[model samples]
Target: MSETTWPWGAGTATGIGSLPGTDVAEAQRIVLGELPDLPHLPELPDRGPGADLIGRTGGLLVELPVELYAARWRIAPRPGKDLRRARDLMERDLDQLAEQAEEYAGPVKVQAAGPFTLAASLELPIGGRLLRDPGAVRDLAGSLGEGLRGHVAAVDRRLPHATVLLQLDEPSLPAVLAGRVPTESGFGTHRAVESEVARALLHGVIEAAGVPTVVHCCAADVPLELIRTAGAVGVALDLALVTDLDPLGEAIDAGLGLLAGAAPALPPPAGRAPTSAQVADRVRRVWDQLGFSRRRLAEQVVVTPACGLAGADPAYVRAVLAACRDAGRRLAEE
Candidate 1:
């Protein structure tokens, strides 16, 4: 990607959407205060049903509506109370973000579940998961694309000074690709999706988003090449979970930026948080192992926590965000 097109600048750091709190206002304050350069809209799943990853994204669908059925989000014929609550939660978060960041003019991120993850998680109206029905999957993808386009526009309108960046969370993508997503009965798994199909659907959503997009999958064996081929400007994943470095190296070489999750998301043992140096070292080692130039590290790499901090203690959440920010600055200095 060209310098002008890349959303993140050197020494930029950001969160992976969710934070540890039920208060959206407080979460926004922490995010804006810590990651001012690349603050993401806070996702507070603790707020209940509609605030979760799947339910939240479901609310964004253009025409497709979803409702909570038997504790699982299912496709519904029409918008219901559950769907309304989800949309309302999202709207409130945007309002808080716009209020807090009225004067900010840098890159701001907003996250939603990716097409594959939503397909794997959401249930079909008739039965089983949307993943089982090819036609439903296609419809869901198209709906999600349109939904994301509107979402981006809404964020742009709210934060006119900020460059809105979209991050698609695809934590279940590896399972969907590997046929590991279990069926509703739990007796068998859904059929694996072809790489070409996955790439095409992902590409459509990226185009629809109409922003500099990043795909975040913190699972092991992240399909780096596929994501890059699908037109993502960046890939976000936990560096610790990466068992293979070759694909990562190849993707970086292919001009895809890296949102490197170097700081641990969970609280450390004995409450010993890693210093900024420790967090920076984690990413530096990866770059050295990949044999990438140090000069490109600051520009091509962004430091972040290993994953969402929603499960973490509030104090730990603040520490991790600070560590990531300082780590990014450290990389720039080096």
Candidate 2:
């Protein structure tokens, strides 16, 4: 298979809802069977709340368990080293990746919570408040960076032939920096004076990950400059929520790969999957709105759902994944 200069592919996550313990190999088979050239591993979400997609992946933060525990984000000390357990879990995941490597013949992605989200999710033990403490935030970021580096190396060792893409999920970034994340009492939010503080910490992780990075955010107001400044090669965003395209257009023109959310994350209308023509039309519409030529579309974009399918109905989830693959094909042919 010839490698395109940009990432022209599909987003990953298990069918929005799937039965528990859906074999990783089966999920990989399902994706590759439908879209052979660009399949990514699926994230099974039935693993319980703590085992939810982000939580499962974000377990990398286990490296900061003591710090996190002190902050009240996690329960008091257990009997073991949380970081070691996390590494073991990650290794197991990498082993699964190795098993599915034959199916995913293109870029292989592994996503985890970004630094900002971790900071927000972790509570400080002192006041049982989130690690919104500026100094603590920095500590969390460094720990995340170090943990991510170890993760990348593990994946490389396990799946040596694949081009690894580390995806940083940062849904809390804008809210964290803008003070939109409300306090426990819900009366107000804490604002970070230097948004750059968070940005720089995230940037450090991206740099340290030692692989091409994509910062994914399903929320509004994705900070284009911050993402680019972090040295990310791609940005995955929910297309339905894009109100402003100017900055995105500039970024696309600047050679960033876009995992365009062309397909809806929810199930399509009824038992019907969205047809190729409909998806092609949506892609065309978005590009036309940007005033970009059709010929350049393939080089700049990959089709995906607006976000992970963790909350959708199971049948609909499968349909959406199939729809996204078909949509990418239809758009490419168009």
Candidate 3:
């Protein structure tokens, strides 16, 4: 919680969430091997149905239940096979992680759909997205807060030696703020959520987690100041999409963590990943341009892939993750 106590220690690296395959055991092995300092539980969205971000997170809710209907996720009557499969897959993943990293003792990250994104994606039983109803959105946030607390506690209990780090994935946050989410009819757009409301919703989940939390969005229009003010300890975004550094500077000044997405999520045309020096150079240039002290770069920043590794092949995913770890080591040498 303090500026001096970093969960991943100094100049470490981590992923944005999600891996390349369905083999949960292999995912854990690669993650722990490549990013030892901040290995995260791999999200296997490829499992389909309940394994995707929305269903997986919805399955974690305490009372609220959701189901797939006509290709949309709506509030459900009860936990169906789809959602049951999701929770089962999650349990299996944890079981595999516990077996693989039985002796691991470090910061372990876990991710889920953030409250704003969940509301935008989940359909209400009354025939509309939850984002269209303020009360429904508030209620969903409360539910997610309670669910996340339990999820984090479960991870902590499973890996007692490791510190659990929560990463809330809100890739649709920019659209949520821009009023770009389409209505159920797919014709009209929904109203933009006010900044105050957005901050409160995010704050609720973060507070409920009761641990160091990071907000990750790979979009170009990330709300750096909003998440920082909402109490997120770290902000993860695609470095290639960012240009202005004023807000990032302020965040660093305030002791906020920066998960710099410097490596390519997809394979490069050159047919090989960037070297450690090359990857760290991008972060160094950004730090220099931001007028930050070089000495603090390792303390306040973390190297990561530009986004989730779900699109890449298994080999490419491992290379990108290894590149991130090497980049962090290079940064530490400075």
Candidate 4:
């Protein structure tokens, strides 16, 4: 856990997805200048297609893309070389990011798409169905776990000065397990049981990363209990979509950290960017509803926007992160 109770921070996403043409160092400094409490590393998605914000979080699965669909994932194994070219590319990026993160003095978070989401997004070659083969899913999970261990180490090596937090982005988990993934012809889907096998797959990756991990799902009806059971130290969710806080309340009591998305990711109608006082007020309201005192609230909460600011204007994105930091500070002091 961070020394501060309410460790305010924003997601890796910023207005400009990637830091390509602009100065990466300047971009990170600009973000830190606004929120010094819990500044996460910036994700520069403009780098390329493979470097998409969701894929570059250092938790990529090797060989699964081909297993899913040789033509679709565009994966190929180059011969005569022990390591693949993509792995080399990853190491280069990691080296640069680690060197750049030296300017920030707080813990930095690295984000990645979780296993379920990956399986759903990718496709199978023959029929276009994603790893429907149980064997394929297991292979993907193990490979991802192996990859994450190395990725974590690489980040730590690059930014030894900062505490690295791994964030598993799993917006598709619930739907996938419910067998909601549409068939190629939109006629069929598979329904996975909640506790039986789904939980174990999620748990394996968390255990492999072996670092302080946080699971983030911007969708509504977040499975709070399952996430906590997956051994995640923290869970980030959109407060607006949360219809039930009972499970979250229990998770909090058990010491699971909460990155509560208080403000909307989209621009507000015309109000000033929510102030620390105003944000704290909202926290107070939520706490009162949950029957938890303000003191306890600080220990279990982290103020943030309802979701990533990827779609928001650049100016609004910066403002949101700044607002979140201020709110967290105010609540912590209270």
**Residue ranges of candidate 4 with Cα displaced over 4 Å:** 1-23, 46-48, 57-59, 63-93, 103-106
The whole-model C-alpha lDDT of candidate 3 against the native structure comes to 0.88
**How far off is residue 34 in model 4, in Å?**
2.4
- Summarize candidate 4's per-residue lDDT along 1-334 as a digit string, tens digits: 3353433342222111223233456556656566565656555554444455434532256444332123234222322121233344456556656665655555667677787776666555455544476766676677777777777887777777677677888888878767777766788875564555667888898899878778888788677788888888889887778778788788877778887778777778883467656766776677778887677677677777776655566677667677677777777677
Our tally of clashes for model 4 stands at 6
Per-residue lDDT of candidate 3, residues 35-59 (tens digit): 9999999988887878888988988
**Candidate 2 C-alpha lDDT tens digits along 1-334:** 1233654343222121222354556665565555555555566655433344334544665345532343233423442454344445445556776776733446666778887777677666555445457787777777778877887777677766666777788888888767788776778787753667766887788877777888888888998778877788878888888899898888877767777776677665575656656756776788888888666776567676678766566566566677766767666665
Off by over 4 Å in 1: 1-5
Per-residue lDDT value at 240 in model 4:
74
Ranking of predictions according to lDDT: 1, 3, 2, 4
Question: What's the lDDT for residue 211 in model 3?
Answer: 89
Best by TM-score: 1
Clashing pairs in 3: none
Residue 23 of model 4 has an lDDT of 42
Sorted by TM-score, highest first, which candidate order results? 1, 3, 2, 4
